[model samples]
Target: STVLLTGANGFIAATILRKLLERGHTVVGTVRSESKATFLREQFKAAVDSDKLKFAVVDDITAPGAFDEVLRAYQFDAVLHTSSPFRYNITDIDEELLQPAIQGTTGILDSVNRVAPSVKRVVVTSSFASVVNRTKGTWPGKVYTEADWNPTTREEGLKDVGSGYYASKTLAEQAAWDFVKEKNPRFTLTTLCPPMVYGPPEQEVPSMVKLNVSNLDIYDIFNGASDPRYGVWVWIDVRDLAEAHVLAWCDAAIAANQRYIVSQGNFSPQMFVDYIWKHYPERAAAKGINKHSPGKYYSDEGIYGVDTSKSVKDLGMKYTPIEDMLRDTLKRFEDLEAEGK
Candidate 1:
């Protein structure tokens, strides 16, 4: 069965794509340019040459029925809609986050509705932002779950807490459900919600290993040292996330129409860093990074604990500890830089 993965080149989605390939699933992925086909081919040689992978350029997702033509030819069995604007900092929330997040989703759904009736399952990538309420402002608690929607997450509201990015996801997902309700669509919908996805490099994608989301605690994991949060806190591994998705695909008992918080155990980056530092002290000191720090650098206020029991017991998700993720992430980057050196 062919899987249609939008945002084929995205950081997180690529992990899903790699996992799909490993599972012997045909993947029809989207890229922004015809020129990228060669690069994708090179990167996905195993899948592409196996006659199980194909690529198409979806230059602008905002175009009405953007994916109809592609799906017209191939009957995709599943759709992994992972293309959403993800940026830590943004000034114009409307233009940067809302437009792409909303239109891109609706536009793809519009196409999917028209073309691929064969698609049975559609997994959309959402975020913890959509689940937990505004923390920087007013947070009810430090724990959240799939049952709760972010407090300010009105889905259809002016830029309040979510600004535009979160608004977009909340709205777009709402729209998807609404659309499904109206049409009684053939496909089942599930959303994968990840909170500060932290883990080691399962593959060579730079985004997978690099701490791209934060410098000084971007919702989870502190900077400079391993925080006590690592001992009791919760964090999601990208691998675990991928595993949960795969399990969702297979598990029939689980609710097909629902969201899952895809994370494992929470540990501080310091424990992970120190673990690696112990093994590679020379590597650490050479990098000129401050190796010593203390206290609860990773805080519940910074990163509220999330319950993934549903995703775990239902989808059978086993998350990777933060320590291994930290060491592996650092090692991967260190190796990458060394390659150039």
Candidate 2:
């Protein structure tokens, strides 16, 4: 099947791209930079040069039908919308975060509307951001599931309404669902939401540029900062997340406007620290840091967890065990330091 993935060369999306290639699907990924696309061509050269993979430049989402030219020309069978602006802090919050997120959804769906019959399914990389917030984002002590929405509307006040990224995603997802129901297009749409996603880097970007990463977020948990507004914890392996994307696209039963919480298990930063201390004592201590950061850092329980039952039940995806996934991730981080990539 011919597949199109927006934000093709991102951390998690790169994994999804690799999985799609392994399955023998024809892939054409959209990148904002032709130079980055050239790097992808080398990394996935066999696919790119062999005509199994292609790249298109799409620099703006607010551009009407940002992907229309490519979508119309290629006749893709599936589309994965994996690109979104991620920011911890935004000066012009609405433009940087909201515009791409909410507007990007509109643009992608517009392309689908333009080519509804040709596109079989569209998978959106959403977040648990759609479900809860950091402080009183949802409830004081609840594990968010597919049934829950952010519930933290504009009425809730922004002091502790969590990050702007949450606002962007929650609003964007709601808007997408509204559009899907109103239009009732032929294609199926599914949103895969994960939280606190942590894993090793997949590709090399400019060493000068640093994206706010999950691994570092976890590291911050060890430094004694806790947000007491949540209790449900959720984490997913990068590789497993890639595989789940495949299942989301290939499975017939997963359909339009459905949301799947694509998490493997739940863990607080404290518990995850303890987990590493027990399993990987040497590595943890070797980093010139305390191996355990339980009570000092996070609460015994926090609202960072999610229920993976729905994804497991419906998609038949078997998530990798937490220990193995973390072990490999840390090792890869060390390997990067060694190679200085």
Candidate 3:
């Protein structure tokens, strides 16, 4: 299969690309600039040499016909759209979060419908923020599934960065469903929503200071800068996520226009501290891991749970344990630190 993966240089997308390439699929990754395209080629020189990977540039996903040329050029069997603004620090909520997310999603679908009729499936990367009402405190014993939708308005998103990101994901995913219903596109659409994704980086990172947003949160916990008071307590390894994307794309028997929640399990910073203190005592002592009280960093009793049975049953997905996730991630962190990154 030939897959068109948007944001292929991103942390998740890069892993997905690697998985697809390993499965002998031809991959055309879309980046926003020539420099990034060059970087991807150099990074995946083996795949490029084997003619298994190629790249295209789409400067703006929100522009009308932004993906038209690229879609028209490739005979893509599937598309994995993972390109959208996700930074917590936003200057303009509409410009940064809402517009790009909403427009970028619809634009890709529109282009695929118009130009890439051969494409059979499209997978989008949504978030748990789209389903959970985060404004209210976490509800204990409340198990969230794909049936839930966040009831947030643009005005509500404008109030803060986190809320705004929630609104963006909710509305963007909503727009995707609406487009399929109204436009009646030929390809099946599936959305995957994972909360608090963490794992080792697959894409290049110049420095720890410039780590991606999701990984940055994990790093903060190690450095004891992140407050457990604001923890979400759910996580999925990136490797598991990358496999889920492939399974979702390949499985056509499952219903279309469906959403799947992919998660490993619940977690908190205190658990990470405990793991570090037990496994890497010297490093933990050097980093002052036990300086803070673990009780304060644990998830509140009212924290909610997510149902991931659909992914496991339908896609044959298996999750990695949180302990393994922390160990692998910390190993990568230490390697990067040794390199002065």
Candidate 4:
């Protein structure tokens, strides 16, 4: 299969690109710049040398028909769109978060519909934000599935960065489904909604400052910047999430035009802290990492539960244990530190 992966240099997309190549698929990855393309080429030298991996630059995904040129250039069997912004430190919510996410998604779909009839499947990296209801504040009995939709309005999104991100994901995914129904494109769509993805990145990290958002949350624990207690405990390993994308793309049996919630179940900041303390005791002690009373900060009281049964049953998903994920993540950080990065 020939696949097009947008945001190929991203933390998650790097792993997806790797899995796609390992599965014997030719991949054309889209990055924002040639520097990123060079970085990816270095990261996957064998793939690039073998002509299994290639890259194209799509500088601004928000622009109208941002993907048209790329779509027309490649004979793509499928596409994995993971190019939306996820930052929160922005002033203009509409410009930074909303417009890019919505337009980037719709633009790609429109471009594919118009130019790439050979493309049969489109998989999007939607967020758990789209499936979570913020208003409920973790309704105790609520078991969130793919069926749930975050009812964040545009007005609510404009209020703050967090709300804006949630609303952006919700509205963008909504627009995707709406486009499929209204336009009836030749291809089918699959969206994966995963929560708080965490793992070692397959791409190059020049410094700790360059860490992706979710991995940054883990780094903060040692840096003394994180609160001991946090909510929305669900998360997935990046490798697992990447596999889910590949599985969703190739498996025809997995229903199309549906959202899959890919999660490894519940977790808390304390759980991460505990794991580090137990495994890397020296580093934990050096960093003065608190071994927050076992399970004290973790509770099911105010947090919602996630059901990954659908993903497991449908995509044949299997989760990477938290221990392994943390170990690899910490090891990656150690390597970076040794390199003085």
Q: Tell me, by TM-score, which candidate is best.
A: 4
Provide the RMSD of all predictions against the true structure, rounded to 1 decimal.
4.4, 3.5, 1.8, 1.4
TM-score list, all predictions: 0.82, 0.87, 0.95, 0.96
- Evaluate all candidate structures by whole-model CA lDDT and list the values in order: 0.66, 0.73, 0.85, 0.88
Q: Is candidate 2 or candidate 4 better by TM-score?
A: 4
Estimate the TM-score for candidate 4: 0.96
**Highest lDDT among the candidates is held by which one?**
4
How do all the candidates rank in terms of TM-score, highest first?
Answer: 4, 3, 2, 1
lDDT of 1 by residue, 180-271 (tens): 78877777888887766654433334332243443224212222233323322445767667666666665543648878887774455555
Residue range with the least summed lDDT across 10 consecutive positions in model 3: 291-300
Report clash pairs, candidate 3: none
Error of 1 at 334 (Å): 2.0
The CA-based lDDT of model 1 is what?
0.66
Q: Order the candidates by lDDT, highest first — what do you get?
A: 4, 3, 2, 1
Better of 1 and 2 by TM-score: 2
Return the TM-score for candidate 3, rounded to 2 decimals: 0.95
Instruction: Give the per-residue lDDT digits (tens) of candidate 3, residues 224-253.
Output: 565343557678999999998899877645
List, residue by residue over 1-341, the lDDT tens digit for candidate 4: 99999999999999999899989999999999989888789888999999999899999998888898989997999999998888878999999999989999999999999999999999999999999988887677679988899988999999999999999999999999999999999999999999999998787788887788888888878555665646467899999999999989798546588789999987777878887777878888888877778666445466678999989888899999888999899888778878897
